[model samples]
Target: MGTLYYGDAASPIEIEDRALAHVKVVIATKLRRGESFTLSWAHGEGQEPGRSTVWLHPSIPLRFAFTEAEPALLSRAWIEELATSANSSGGLMIVPEPERGGETGPR
Candidate 1:
């Protein structure tokens, strides 16, 4: 598991390390381009069991913490999906996907 400590929230948002790593990449790209968007996810099993969304901005403090020692493989297909959403006015939604397009296969 990993936690994304974001904004004024006292509790960090929990996420899988692999997913968080991918999100980190997408978010960093948007921030670098001076864009802002929403990041949303359905709560994972064993958590609060609801959905959440965050308004991401370049000025907000953000941190990513991973439990795994070594970096997990990424999924480019997933990243493309995320990017597409980020480009839309509706913003990004962190829906689940079977990992693909990283070491698993071509993007």
Candidate 2:
């Protein structure tokens, strides 16, 4: 698992390491362009069954920590899909990546 620490929040948002790796790329591109938007995710059914949205701004501090020692491979198709969502009026919506064997793209 990986954790994304945003702003001054003490508790970090937990996500699968591979998923977080891909999300980081999309977020970095947006921030690099001085763009700000919301990133929303639904709480897992095992825990709170609600959704939460976070405002992603250049001013806020963001950190990504991965549990696995090695970095997972990344996919360009997934990044592009995420970029499309980020560019939409509704902002970025976090979704799970496709299955490992079924996924294909750049490293």
Candidate 3:
């Protein structure tokens, strides 16, 4: 059981095989560009709070143990669901996908 330490609290987040891919892509992109950020989530109603300032690095392997369980990406529909959830959840700390077709700024 891998542990996700957030803020001053810690919990074990279950990561399935599929979700690991998205996590790897997100983390790798941020680390590759020498960016650092925080991932925060409220585990329960009034827990001690949860957050982690991950210092992503390129050498980090895309392994299950290093990723968090975000089951929202199980399918295309789920991906769209997650996108909506992320936007509503104050936006997650992820490397923004590059703009396309002359679009400017981060997506």
**Clash-forming residue pairs, model 2:** none
State in Å the error of residue 103, model 3.
Answer: 23
lDDT of 3 by residue, 1-107 (tens): 23333333334444334443444444445556865443433343344576433333345433335443443233433334334433443443433233223322221
Q: Considering summed lDDT, which 10 consecutive residues are worst modelled in model 2?
A: 98-107
Worst 10 residues of 1 by lDDT: 98-107
Candidate 2 on 30-78: residue-level lDDT in tens? 9999999998877755667888889999999999899988877787667
For all candidates, the clash counts are 0, 0, 2
TM-score per prediction, in order, is 0.86, 0.86, 0.35
* Per-residue lDDT of 23 in model 2: 85
Q: RMSD to native for every prediction?
A: 2.8, 2.4, 9.8
- Cα lDDT tens digits, model 1, 1-107, are 99899988987999888778778888999998988899988888987778988899999999888898778777878888888888888788876765565543211
Per-model CA lDDT versus the true structure? 0.82, 0.82, 0.40
Off by over 4 Å in 2: 99-107
